[model samples]
Each structure stands twice: as structure tokens, then as C-alpha cells.
Target chain A: MSAGALPPRVRIVEVGPRDGLQNECVALGIDDRLTLIDRLADAGLRDIEAGAFVSPKRVPNMAGSGELMQRLPRRAGVSYPCLVPNDTGLDAALAAGCTDIALFAAVSETFSQRNTACSIAESMDRLSAVARRALDAGVRVRGYLSCVIGCPYEGAVESRKVADMAARLIDMGCYEVSLGDTTGIGTPAQIAALIDTVAAQVAVTRLAGHFHDTWGMGAANVWAALQRGVTVFDASVGGLGGCPFAPGASGNVATEDLVYMLDGAGIETGIDLRALVDTARWISARLDRAPASRVARAFPPTPER
Target chain B: MSAGALPPRVRIVEVGPRDGLQNECVALGIDDRLTLIDRLADAGLRDIEAGAFVSPKRVPNMAGSGELMQRLPRRAGVSYPCLVPNDTGLDAALAAGCTDIALFAAVSETFSQRNTACSIAESMDRLSAVARRALDAGVRVRGYLSCVIGCPYEGAVESRKVADMAARLIDMGCYEVSLGDTTGIGTPAQIAALIDTVAAQVAVTRLAGHFHDTWGMGAANVWAALQRGVTVFDASVGGLGGCPFAPGASGNVATEDLVYMLDGAGIETGIDLRALVDTARWISARLDRAPASRVARAFPPTPER
Candidate 1:
């Protein structure tokens, strides 16, 4: 990042409220969920992942995403996107008035089989169907490609494979595609190479970077992608949401850490970092675990405090 | 990182006992300190920083480093390094039977002024004096070069300047010179380039990698250094310790996370991940903050989970 270069004007998608909280076994009440989202909105996050609409039986923690969405503060201009894994999930999100929806795919065929109980082609077809339906219904679609660099089951995903997958999603009507190093096994050089290859097919403007901190290279991978002209990022609040598929995979790049990096680099992320800290604290307590965010832990020591 | 090939072994200097916890306002009991070090040792860590010997009035958290060192567990093949900023710290650590001592310097002159309350040359002189005394005492001296990539007072650090400071430290009889990206502004390309430049003047084996996660690139930076055949790394348990000169900087790369990366890549770190997590949890509780480790959270959901 150049010292006097104009800071990037970027849209930060806060995944804490949805992806951050959904995977936990902790059963936070709907009130707490609403408070979490409202607090995040107040913190200046223009795009917050309100919740996932997966089956409550499978994801009890996200049972009331619909109810929580209904009670959200009526704030114009702040887009709330939700996850849609299947038609049922799409219906759930649509009923909740989600104008933007995301569909996820795994780079490794083996991972897709285990994660979504479908083959790569089958999963893409499902997402394509969802994309077409959502687009016809006047909603924007975002595609997520997981394990773009490596996978626990299949290991080292080729860059060309990732780019092909991304291009397929773009052709399926996804306005943007997020390439995720779900296992956090990316080296900067490898990651840069991956982005370069992906950019050959997709415009950099239509790309977002998502990384897990499994091997502790999430932010570095993000930086590598950003240097390749990726402007959007997907972060979880308190850095929550470890991959259930990748047993040792940790949380995604932390929202607080992301905001700090952007702010330091003179990029405008429109997030109140202190407020994110408060949200991280609240959610972590609900889950009874330490927050995954470095910025949350690195907050200024209390004076007399 | 090849499976069949000999895995690269990175020597991680556990700095939590000294550098990590020294700046904390929290007062940990001697029993807690010993327990923490014991856990780390059991976790396969051969080098565990027991504590620092700074004055109680100046740095209250490290006042008991001298006492803690005296009561450390009698483990064979372990090196208990302590921070000896000057003659006083050196005397305290040596009396406590610490064979290894560390001295600090900064690549940025401005940071050296604020952090040490002295010029860079003055800090090096102090370090040289300590190194001479320790060498005469049959103790190994470890030199630290802080703000190697960027500084709080000085926004960007030149690689050549870092090499110069590191070279001086090695010449002063320090056994190994650990490079600190104090402001966490280093990217992989920058790191690789710096290592290449530094390797021209110094034996690569004598240099260690020390990075802060403030920008979320610490582990990536470590990997970059590793690719260039530099094997030593300095990490803190729970990713503790930040550059006091750089306000809001994240702590050093979490020890557990570093061990995970090395282990995952088929490299030998000789550190047990589970034991490291336990130690991190204990210390994080003491400080009333979350562990800065990604792998700790990335652990498989326990039955107690």
C-alpha cells in the first residue's frame, strides 16, 4: 500500500451476526441475536450477514434467524445478506426479505461430497438454480468458493481449478465471487499466484477474499489478494465460525483485525472497531469462549481500567 | 513442506515467559508462572522464556522473573531465556541460573529513542556490554532487532537498515539475532527480499523470525523467512506481547498457531499443540483476555468440547 495513495473505498461484509454465530452450539436467545445485529449496524457496518436459514434441526443455534431478521431495525441502505444452501434455505432467506443471498461451494470434490452431500457439479447446479431464482426475484447473488488453496480431505487445490470454479459461478449469475482459503494453508506467493490465475478469467472488481486462520495466514492471504485488486472481504466478528469440515480449521479473518488493517492502510471500511470489540465480547460470552479476533484482544488497556 | 522430503525444522523461541508477559499490568503468582512454563515444556517446547528481570517499579509484571527463574521446573535439555535489558537484569537472570539472556534493539532509530529512551547506537552499546558480560559468564546472548519492517514513529522500515542492525547485533557476540516486524507492516515479498539482502552479510542460520500479527500476516511472514532457509522463529504463547512503542499493535504470532503451521506443513517445531492450548487458556484467563492463537480455537470440538 503506498503511503499517500488514495485509500480504497470498499464494502466490508460483517459475517459475525450470521456465520459467526450460526455454527456455535451455544443457544443465544433471539433477543441477543437481534442486539448483535443492531449493535453491528450501529458500528457502521453497511453489510451485515444477518443469519443463515439452514434447518434448525441441523443448526439449532441459527433456529430463529427468520424471527431475528423480522425484528431488525429498519435502517435504509444497510444491506443484509443471508446464506442459502438449498431451496429451503432460499425460501427461508426470501421470507426474511433478504435482498442479497450467498451460495457456497467447495473447491475440492471430496469436500463438496462431505460438506454438502453432493458432487461439485451437482452443488454448482443447485447454486445456479438458486442464483437464477434469486435473480428473477430481484435479488443479487454472491458465490463463495471454499478451500480454494487446500482442503483437509483432498489437499492442494490447483489454482486453475479454483479459477474455473469461480468463472463458472460468475456465469451462473453471481455478481461477485469470493475465493476462500478455507484451511488457511496458503503462502503469500502461492496465494498471489492463485489470484493472478483467477483474475485472468474474472474481473478483479467481482472478487472478494475470504480466509480462515487455521494455519494463521488468513490476513496475509487477504493482503495478497488485495494487492491483486480484490476490494471486498468476508470477516467474522470476533473471528468466529471455524470449518466443521476441516477439523483443525479456525475462524475466518477477524472483522476487527480486517478493520484495523484497512484503517492503517488508509482504506475506508466504515466500521467502528471499538463497537466490534463490544460485540465480540458479548458473543464470546454467550458462547463461553475467547474471541478469535486479535484486535479485540489488542484493545487499549483500561485506564484505572 | 514436502511430505517425503525432510521437513524443515523451525526453532521457535518461546518468549511468553519474558517478553510476552513483561508488559502486562496483571500480577501472576509464582505458582501460575511455574505451572505455565511446565505446561509449555510438557508441550514439547525446549525453549521457554521464564521471565524478565526488569525493575519492579518500572515493569511490575516482570518483577518476579528473577524469583520465577529460580523455581523453574528442573527439565533436562531446556533453555530458559530471560530478558536482560541491562547489567541489573543480567545479574538477576544469571544468579537465577539462566544460561540464555536476550537484549533488545530497533531497526528504526525513532523507535529506539522512544522504546529504550536512548538512541539506536546507545541501545546497541548497552546490548554489546550485556553480551560481553554474559559471554564472560558462560551465558549465551540472544539479540533482538525490533521494528524491522515498520515503526510507530517511523512509518516504514528499510530492509537494508534492518540488515545493518542485525549484523551489528551478531558482531556484538549475540548467538542469534531475531528480527521483529514491530509494526506488522511486512508482506511476504518484502520479507523474502529483506531475508535475501540480510543473508548476503550474515549467516542465515544465526537469524530468527519474529513477527507481530497486528496486520494478520505474522505467520505468512514466518513462512516467507522459512522458504529462504532461515529456521529460527520467536513466538509467544497465546500470541502475547506487542510493541509498546507501536500502540495497538497485535502480539507476536501465537506459539500454538506457529506450531500448527509447521506441523501441518510436515515441519518439526517440537511443540505440542494441545499442551500449548492449555497454557494459552490459562494465561489468557489470567489477563482476562482471549488467546491470540488461531489453532487453539481451531482445535477439534472436544467431547467436553
Candidate 2:
């Protein structure tokens, strides 16, 4: 938070099960999704995005999210969050006994229309209704602001628009807002400007960075965000998820790689790096792909030497 | 150079022809090496590590450094620097008409012994001789300090030792020193500490960051160094080179990716990104492997869209 000082510890929101698997070509079974959440908890992640309440026809891989929430092993400190787009999704999440839900919105008008089939204001209205209903049921709600940095349809996003959207989400009773670089086209300068603009209106503690590694700038952007006093991040295990807009681009920043850098920087993440590495390896094996995590690929567990 | 400001213009030392191709499983011919150098020059990279004068048996891929140098088209503004380990290598490099040479040493004692077949002190002595002779012969000598952050054999490296080695290299009449994370195991904190310590002993203007992307922290580390006044970076085209000590790891930061970040950040690199992207695609196709560069993979040149 101070000049050249990092937070003592940061919270990692594991989105491998929801944000990650939702984009994968392989349709993982409900059991696999449950196991992934369980492994993330065992690896000391307290915030895990378990699944999303979306149309099965649209996202077949996340079809059994409700089922996953029902059978997921409950941990003491871990909270499983599910994405709920509207009142219908919220009702399904509540029926499945979900305790935490996330509302997704886009700051760019074009992206808002393209992604959610509505303008930014209309999407916000829907999200506000879902947030209000979820809060009435004593369910904690988080918000995801996509295209906060760049949009595929639109070139660059305004920082003022991002700040206003985040403030609106917080006013709607969302606990935290995760800024998503959906196109992964952000550089450090843009990240600094965005964080600075948003921090002026909202506390840095309430902001989260969800960067993709499409151009290998994820860690750099994360560093920029940290310098601006943001302490929460969204990462996917084995770096699952690809940018549908930008072909051949990578997905979210790998949790293992993020944890490795955080730990090496002497920042406490309350994460078991080895255990997280194991989880990454496990899921990557199940996906029949080499672990997309650079740390997992470079530093596999070695016997005493 | 300042606390949070990046340099307006940075120098990119392209090492793809030598550092990159040398580690490739495919052995490119002398003509191909010349073509790679010319292509890099055409892409607006003035500084290029053209070849290294090493043992033919040890690195057959770079065995024809002399012939490649002889046939390389002489560009007025572009300089091809060769890696010269000792007096013998210096002699070969001089015979090849190299005007610029680089001498490498390791700060970690174990890495020095393993990589150069000598102790740290002995390796420095050899490098000192090469630097002195090259300087007297009107050749610009650059120093490379490897294992400045982490060593595969020795584990964590101390910043003080790295600073001392860099000071010794500068004292030996080397024009500049490129601090290298040979194992690619450095984090931002370590990068800041190393650069700060080294800056105390040597002018920050004379320091360069040569980070590998083995663990995907290359861009972040580079950003840290940039914050601390590093103005030059060593990157491989198509992300070539591999650490023999660290298996299954990536090579130097990809030149295209680095340039893309710099350009996006409003920094001047004097490179035509589209031309560089074409070079990466051209070379990658020759190797029959996808370009390891994230930017090249994501944003290929497209006709008016």
C-alpha cells in the first residue's frame, strides 16, 4: 500500500472450476469439478469459484454446477462462489444451497452488449436485481467487471467508466469487484491508470485483479496492481481457459505461477505451493494437456538431491 | 529509471541467432544464421548477439561463427556482438571481424564451476583477460553476470555477490554489464534488490536485465528492473534458448512479446512490430514449432480488417 511496500498477505480467488472449466474444450464431469474444488481447498485456498449457474446448452462444461455445489465437500474456512447472471441463475444457486454468488458485467458498452445481450445500463439493472435478491437471502455477492482494460469490439476502455461501474456494484451490496482484462491487452501503464482511477472512488482493498496471460503480461500487470495497493487476484489452476475473442491466446494467469511469484517476493499468500502444484498437475493430467503453468513445468517435485 | 517511471526509450539486445538457435534441437546452417541476423536488423534491432565462439564439439550449432560473421552484410548502424569466453575465443572472434564482444561470468561459485569448468575467481580472471585484450584492440566488451538471482546448483544467490561481480566486470573495462537470471528463478523483490545493490556499485545506465522466462516471471522481473533504471534488455527471437540445468523451461524473454509490452506502454523501441512478428513466424516455421512468443501467437499480421 505504501511506496515500494507490498501487502503482508494477499487473497487468491481460485476460479479454476468455474471461469476455467467453463471455457475448456473438454467437458469435465461433475465429480472432476468437485474434486478440483476439494483439491483447491486442501491447498489452502479460502476463496474458490465452484461453478456458474448458466444455460447447459450454452456452457455444457459447467452444466452440472448446481450438482457440484450440492455434493462439494464443505471446508471450515473455504467459501465456494458461483456465478449467477440474473434472478433465474440466483434462484438456481439458492436452490443448490450456494452461500456465495458473483455477478458479471462489462464496462465497455460494446462488450456489455456482445457478452450479455444488453447495454451496460441494462446489464447493471439486471445485476442489481440479482445482487439485491441474493443479499436478501443473506448470500454474499461479488462482482466481475470484464473488459475493464480493453474490449475486442471496442479498442480501449475508459478508467472513469470502470470506476463508476465498480462503485455501482459496491452500492448494489457486492462485497468485492474483480476487474477482468478479458482481451489481455493491458500493459503496466494502463493497469496503473485504471487502478489509480478506481482506487480514488473505491478502496483498493475492495478491488481484485483478474488478468489473462495472452501476451505474457499477467505477472507484470499483477505487479502493477500490487503497487497500487490491490491485494486480491483471480487465478486458474493449470492456467485453464482460453480467450475466445483472441485466438491462440492463453487463459487466466496460472494459480501455481502466481503463487510462486508471490511467495518468492516474501509475500504471505497462505498457500501451499507444493500442494497447489500437485493440484495443477492432477487437473492438467486429467485434461490430457501439459500443465500450462510455467512453475509446474519448470519446477516439478524432485526427490532429495 | 525513477521510482515508478519507465525509461522513455529502451535498448533491446536481440540474442535469438546465438542464444536462441544454439539451444534449438534443430541445427541451422550458416546461411540461415546470417539470414536471422539480417532479419533482426531489418526489424530495427540494432544490437544483436550474432554468434558465439565456443568449442565446436561443445556447441556445434554455433561452430561457424567466423564464417557467418564473414558473410554477414555490414550494416552501418547495426552491430553484431559475439560471445567470447577466453583468449582463444577472443582470437576467433577477432579473426571473424567482430567489433563488439561479450564476456560472461557467474556470481554463484557452484554455477561458475559447473558452467565454465572453473571457480568463480578463476572465471573472473579469464573474463578479465578477455575484456582487457578486447578493449585494447578497440573492441567494445560487454559483461554478462549469470546466476545473479538464483543458481540451479547453489540455489538462491545473494545480491551483494552479484553486485561485487558486476563491479569487477566494470572494473575490467567492460562497457556495460548484463545481469542474468540464468535459471529464470528470480521474483520482482529479488530483481529490485539485485538492481538496487548493483546500482550502488555501478552506474544504472550501464546495467541490463537478461531474464529467462523459465517460470513465467520474466516480464515482471523486467518491469522491476525498469523501475530501478535498467535501460537495456536481452531477449531471444521466438523465445529461443533453453537452460540445460533447468529442464523443460523456456529461454530468454521473447523479443516480440517484450517489444509489444514496451510499445503498448508508450515506450519507444524503434522496432516495427509487424516486421518482427513476421520474422518470428518465418523462423518458427523453419523450426517446425510454434513461436514461443505469446504476442506473435495471438496477433499475427492481418490485412486491412
- RMSD values for the candidates in order, in angstroms, are 6.4, 2.2
| Fnat: each model in turn | 0.33, 0.66
Model 2 error, position A64 (Å): 1.4
Docking class of 2: medium
Q: Which model scores highest in lDDT?
A: 2
**Residues A1-305 of candidate 2: C-alpha lDDT, one tens digit per residue:** 22248888889999999888888777899888888888889899999999999999888989988888888878888899999988889999999999999999998888888778999999999999889889999999999999998889888889999999999999999999999998788987788889999999999899999998888888888988888889999999888886334466588999989999998888888989888988888898888777777888887675545
Backbone clash pairs for candidate 2 read none
TM-score of each: 0.71, 0.97
User: What is the alpha-carbon lDDT of model 2 when measured against the actual structure?
Assistant: 0.88
Please list the residue runs of candidate 2 whose C-alpha ends up more than 4 Å from where it truly belongs after superposition.
A1-4, A243-247, A302-305, B1-4, B243-247, B303-305
Error of 1 at A96 (Å): 4.6
TM-score of candidate 1 versus the correct structure, residues matched by position = 0.71
DockQ of each: 0.23, 0.61
